[model samples]
Target chain A: MKKILTIAALALSFMFLTACDSMDSPSPLDTRASDTSGELNPDGLPGDATMGADSGLQDRGLNSINGFDPENINPEDIVYTIYFGFDQYAVGSSERDKVKSAADFFAQNPDMKIVLVGHTDWYGTEEYNMLLSDKRCRAVSDYMGNIGTDPSRIEIIARGEAGATMDVAKNSPEAKKDRRVDIVKVK
Target chain B: MIRRVFLGLFAGIICTSALFAEDAGTIRKDAGRLNVPIYRVAITSSDADTANLAKRAFGTHGSFRLSAPSQAQFIFDFAPSGGNSVKLTIKGGTVYEQVFSGSNSVEALMKACDAAVMKTIRTPGYFAGKIVFSYSKNGGQTSEICTSDMVFRNVRALTRDGNDSLMPHFSPDGSKIIYTGYYRTGFMDLLLIDLNTNTRKVFAAYKGSNTGGSFSPDGTRVATILTSTGNAEVWTASANGGGFKRITNTSATESTPSFSPDGRTLIFAGDYRGAPQIYTAPATGGKPSVVRTNISGYCSEPVWNKVNPDLIAFTIAQGKGFQIAVYNFRTKQTKVVSRGASTSGPKWLNDGRHIICTKSNGANRQLYIIDTETDSQKPLHTTSFGSAKEPDFAYTAR
Candidate 1:
């Protein structure tokens, strides 16, 4: 009877340990220090919120003045468009989740390649918009790299107003839909 | 389209019959509403179809007016060939009487008219010139390069790659065209095409981006933008793509570099000061200076007038859109050339008084030629392609 009791105790202990391991395993994106509060850095980059004084995200290659989250993104999602502010390449606090989600998707699909096509509205010059779109794509690429996506699997394209999702004039609310980076999966 | 026809009909019935009919005996120098020089030409064709084609071709032109064959200063006669060809002859008060043969009767008649005007006015004729522009196809995913006459007739594709090709610029001598192509998707390819041979080659296909190519007036070099070294900077290269020299070194983007008539200076658009503005620099590369213009908003795509060196036309951001504007160096005045709608890509015609630009209504984009002196803009009639933009003019002798 004692032997059977010991065997049951061992089984219970193994089950508890397995559950703990499952909970303790770090996310593929967790290699970089994260904000436990799920709050994004106001600087449009990602890192520990407590270390805001330091340019934590800047050192990680993020150049945006605002932040976005790409967490909890599914790789199978057909398309994801992240919009930007007026004449701004900064992914703001409200948009950080998209970045985190993109990072999560990239992490989940190791062999997948993504083309981040950046676009702008018809407000600025074509040359200026081209550069602005490029800067936006760089910001996204930096965040993806920060969260453990292989840089080689990512491509950035500055489409300017060429890939505009909305056909609206400048200064209109609908025009804001054009200023975006479309994350398209190629693999 | 209705407005254009109404204006034409109004001028045809009211001005031609009422105002100018009484003054037909005297040479009406300023008969049209625009108050420009008037040249009356009588057009005659061997067939009624050819005669109707000639009338339609010349109706939209802002230059000559029609008159009775006996009282006309110039006479244009068209002889049709067995096929789609026509032999055009122009003779009258000018020392020019020539017979030119071409495939299309309409195009042949227009060329004959242009030649006649050039003989009388002693100015460079734009009617016989061709324009190379970018047209969006396959739902804007790809763009094809096309060439058309100034009247936007007889359009032929220069590229069938169905890729995103933009910013077509004519070489100084009109023998070649240089453009930026996206045949490789995310990569840019600077392509050069020989108009005579219809052959294309990669002029500068760098890794990052290659765009904004403009040939120098001397045709010895080309100024363009390359991002091979981090950021987009203005760079000049040999006409044959042999030697390359970087022109601007800025963290910001520099683009659309055009050379002055003397080939000593270059005017380009840059955002070094945060907002895009026109800036001038020496062709040999040196410290750049801001263009002294009265425009307060974003300015870009500044092209130096080939005939009038003192005038520089550019695109300025306007109310909910963009418009074409000209900055006069001699008067230090800035005048808006385009009106009512959004216009971009202001490229100067050889006439120095007119410019070709892209005008959009947030849905459709088309090419329009604006006369700066009159502030009059007319849409170019191109083949029913998707959206046509970025037109470059090349003068071809007929």
Candidate 2:
């Protein structure tokens, strides 16, 4: 998560035309400031030291990757699961009320964290469905983000056709019912 | 794995040195006509289970016609040895007879059969590989990650019941597994199960979805789908599950990042060009280039062939269902190799010629081994344990 890896040297490149990588050496990339502590300093580096302009670290984390507390504290389920449209991640206008419900839940329980477990119908490949489900989670998260929900308190999981019935037709309402995100409240 | 296979040539067991001298008689004369080879082989085993399973494995390849010892070119005789080992004696084969041991007799027999494959067919035998998949009972959301031999022998539960554990991938050596499990926090977080220690820990508890965790070839780094950054993107972490680094920077959803056998490039699926297409990016941060499979508009879950890195196996959307297709980089053409009610989630066995995938017919989702070279598909195991999907095979040499 915003990890600044030091390119201690520039010569070592992964050139072992083999299927195995020994856990040896200084571990080519992502040295993580000091250790694998998962701790970030204010500068998002090990300490407050300003990163060198030629560090080439910004290219690594152009998209910020951050860690979250995985504690499952007194989790509760929100009845309204954010249903995504067929092969779509955008939260429908009708689903806005469900997002409001989540917003209201977070507002009522200020110390709670929201877990958006994503899903998809039996429409495409498993991996593609995973991404589609993930975008659904993000859509709901972004909507709640507009409601001022802290991203840190939200954990999104893309389940991707995990719960869908295989025998049913692809477009059946039972199958489409699976293409949604289940909301859970955690501490 | 080809690297290991080459290295295996020098350090290979004394019995398997005849790789180049494999008998050509077993290969059909007109092979490339349909990518199928029908070899006449005979299996002699005192154990019915061993013979039946071996025949199943052979038939699953859509090759090998059962024949008498006198008529067969490759003959295999299996006998239980002192321990959990199988003593395989070949009468009509090139390789010398040897003993293959495993945790049990079935595994031992598979090891022997796989060895026999290398000796006669000149290819890796994945029958001895370990398979990990999520098993859902009666099509429920709650599932468990289970491990078994290729034929579903010695099934062991890694995760518990009443929790969703999906897409478990095997590390190169078959000693560790990384999967997206919600058994812990009720939210999908990547979990690593050390098969040796029988312990599991959170590999990626990132802010967003952490799914599709697969190990890099050499078993050093793990490629996973972490959505924390922007959208779903391919990210790499150390084998110890630390020092995370993002590989592909894309706003389009990215899933299933697989390292080339050389571990230099990554082949993954992204919707950047509208529909899902296979794309390759440098293992290090770089721009991603599209892999024009052209077989279909939707191709996802791309995995590099371990034995033959140039070959790629992915799920391609067919007329109404999806099937496994192999795209040969050299020919720049794709071949659809599987025919199922709905087959997807294909992972290559040690043998580049064969693949392990899931075939769903009605409510029955079962693991199957498909011979891409012959377009032969056969069930690896039964649905007695429930439906299985997303199988990852870790082939360890015997």
Candidate 3:
């Protein structure tokens, strides 16, 4: 009886020790990593681009959207398409030149309006990918806003993981081309 | 003459003893039912289409084992009733006859099979349901909403936007389909397709990502994901696409808000606790509590069982791929249900015992019907249908 009791106690202790060791304090915070994919620069602030931070959207020279169609814009009319990392929406410093290039094109064509369409690689769930695409779009629009463009002029759309490039290896560098945002003129 | 009479009497005595020996507990003491793993059934139909449909229906279920008529405990005999219906006479376990109707032969035969299951097994049979899924062609460049019977026949596109459409789900009544499409605006908007009216309209186009539209059990409300706040949050609207209200007030990007069978609760995938996990909230919107699946940190795409309220199915990360897992609310334990080739996107069949999901094949994927009870996968399509994903099922009586 004593031996049996001892064995049972040992078994219970081992189970307690081994049970849920994986649940320790946010096991593998891929959630945080994915959430922070929309990280902003210097402090990831202004992350809440709610309706493009809509407290003063109309006050900030909001453009009227009546007969604008992004499909009508030619490939050459597009200033620059922003590219992002895997599951990321952050406009990194490397893409600053591209954002500036779009902003410069805007300066050249003040009468025209530009549209931002966001997309992602087909790696995550469909619904989340849809939101992530929007996050990337809002991030670029916010970037354009920071660089002196009418936030209203930048009509944003999210294509999610649509049109994912599959002609090359998925893990290869060329796949980054799939996670991009197009900057088309919507005049 | 006396010897002949004695021999006849002996034969009669021998026959009487043989009959007595075959009585219960008198012979074959080990002939018990302790070894049977599945129900043995025999399916026979004069019509080739009916027989083929019945075979497909019974062959894919794990609870049933198709066998010869002599060895089966149940026998299903089907007869053509009309152009697209069948009259099934089930003989064994319980004897009954039922007339099943559908829009096509496969659908009708499936309904008859489901009737037999209900009459014999006393559990839900989901073979006669319809599935709405998004099929992507041109290498995932553009997708269109499509619907088909459970057998993957009767396939037709609901939307030919020529741009992109995805995450198609059926209303409770199976008369409408709700999905997100890049219709004209180049932005993803919640679009509704009423099968009865053959008309399409925008359900929700609230200035940002509007997707993940699902119907409540009563079909009076819709649960969706809205990004007007710059983050994906659970929101509900009226059945007519009015009375918008946000359900979750958090920075954690939420997706896929599924209502419980009782229509009193909502389960969704969110990163509230720093990672993606299953969480539940009141249908009227309150503090959300995480469901401790404890299976993985990357659990998402949760769909609540419509028949069994205690069950919720989701996708869990497996190595570099993903697999389907089920969580029981009563036991609070989670178990993996499906395997192989980056399978994800689980939606419950009406029986609550099956799920319609997708399995990846490199860049393209295909739809599969999974028997959660046995982890058996039956591909809905043998031929390629491009990349089919995000499947939702609706069960309606014809």
Candidate 4:
């Protein structure tokens, strides 16, 4: 009776050791399978049949994992639409919201990189517009940093007054559309 | 009738006093020293005839008379005729005379009239060692280059039929003239004209508006502003037009380029800084740096003083008027050369002591020479009725 009791204790400790070892592996799905299989097989391990059945159950369970659902996967690419005030690059309340959205997306996906492209209307001089474009890009980048986005993940570029979308007409809605920052996701 | 007569008498007294009193001092002094008497005369005619008709009625004397019909006239005797026939001659629309023996009544009168008109038109100290400039007149609506004396006299129209001919720069040797002209195609190209031969040949058929043609210090190449890529930029090509190299990029509007005294630096006005300001770059083409800043006004048309490399003169607008100011590279300060009103097109004389600039009096514009040492300015020529501007001092023509 004593020998049988000691053997049973040893068997139970072995099962626990295997469970802990699976938990330390890179994938947590393997340990989740062992939790469902209660029996120790003749090979001194969970039976292959039971492991296979558990894997099937794990596959079904994977779909319900929080934040891991395929349908809930955030896109690797992000588009940040920045609207500028009339003849200004100062980040206003509305533009700050756009920047915060971009930052949040970046925070959720830390592996992604962003390019902050600045554009301007055709109303001002080319030289001044070029500088303003640079300022706009920098402003967006700064806002992203304020909201927990890595500074290294952002790059700034300027298009100046060239490539204007507003047909050279200032104070128009189309011109205001031209003066904006296009945050594109690279990789 | 009585009131009219009294008013005429009062006007006669005022006119007589003004003419006799103010005129007597200078006229008598000059005449007495020259041993001559000054005279005033007028020719009367009937109501039925015109002034020319009345003069014709006087016969041969009409042409020679010092006084013409229905016109007030004055004359002064210079010297007794020294057997040189008192003949009236007109050249370039100016009248002159030479005295001779056996003078007819008409001949004597002609000689005296010629002497008086010559005295009034002739300025002794004017246009001496001065350079002239040719500008498109008639508000730039026509392609005519009008010449003005450095002080702005003798404004003769140089070219009448050549439309859009501009940037007339003298060659280094001063024997040839180079300019850009549009020939029917509406594209300005470089042209060289031999001043001695009056022969012209197209120097460069640049693709776009080739203007602001300037001769290199050695006269081997012509540096000009070419708008080849739909944007104006500085370029250098062979003076006879073969090799072309763009000196500036398409990112800016770079025009009005002036070479430094050493020809190693090119100074130009560009929109690189969001406004038209002076910038200097390597003559071989490189990054350009700002030369004039701090003043938030438009600064254009830079001319380097050949003798004083440290000095550069350009026009800057203050309020509603533009003034000519010189920037000293060493001193790092600007001095205004023009006083009130507007000034433009400041060109330095070879001596560097004076600058010829266009001065406008709100109503009319003319050329004025500003002395750097004395800070004094004087009108170059006072006879032109039409507006005159853009005085470019000729360096090689000396």
What TM-score against the true fold does each predicted structure earn? 0.73, 0.78, 0.79, 0.46
On lDDT, the stronger of 1 and 2 is: 2
Is model 4 an incorrect, acceptable, medium or high docking prediction? Answer: incorrect
What digit string (tens of lDDT, one per residue) describes model 1 on residues B1-398?
99999987776665334222323333424322124445667878778656654654444344556778987766777767545456666655222346655456556655665665555544555666678888764245567777776654456666656457788999978888888765433345577777666556667755356677799987889998866565678878887773667778887778789899999898998877777889999988898899968685688989989888888999888776788888889879887878987888988776666788887755566878776754557766532345778888877655
Sort order, DockQ high to low: 3, 2, 1, 4
| Stronger candidate by DockQ (1 vs 4) | 1
Mind giving the per-residue lDDT tens digits that candidate 3 earns over B166-244? 8888899999888887765566677777788666766776666778888999998899887776678898887776677
Cα deviation of B393 in candidate 2 (Å)?
1.2
Query: For model 4, how does the per-residue alpha-carbon lDDT over A1-187 read when each residue is reduced to its tens digit?
Result: 9999999999999977653342221211112223332211212211111101110111111111122211112444337779787556668896777788888877887776676666787544333354456567767877888778887676554545544652334567778888888787755
Candidate 1, after superposition: displacement of residue A162 in Å?
1.4
lDDT of 4 by residue, B306-393 (tens): 8789889887757655788788898787877678757777877655556777776533556677755445576554423444555555
TM-score of 3: 0.79
Mind giving the per-residue lDDT tens digits that candidate 1 earns over A1-187? Answer: 9999999999999977653342222211212224332221212212212111121111112221122212212545435788898777767778778888987877787776677778888676666677678778777777778777787776566777665543464567767887888786755
Determine which window of 10 residues in candidate 2 chain B has minimal summed lDDT. B14-23
lDDT of each: 0.67, 0.72, 0.74, 0.54
In the range B78-179, model 2's lDDT, one tens digit per residue, is 888868999988765234679888878888888888877766666667777788888766545466787777665466666553567788999999999888
Q: Every model's DockQ, to 2 decimals? A: 0.04, 0.10, 0.11, 0.01
DockQ, computed on Cα atoms, for candidate 2: 0.10
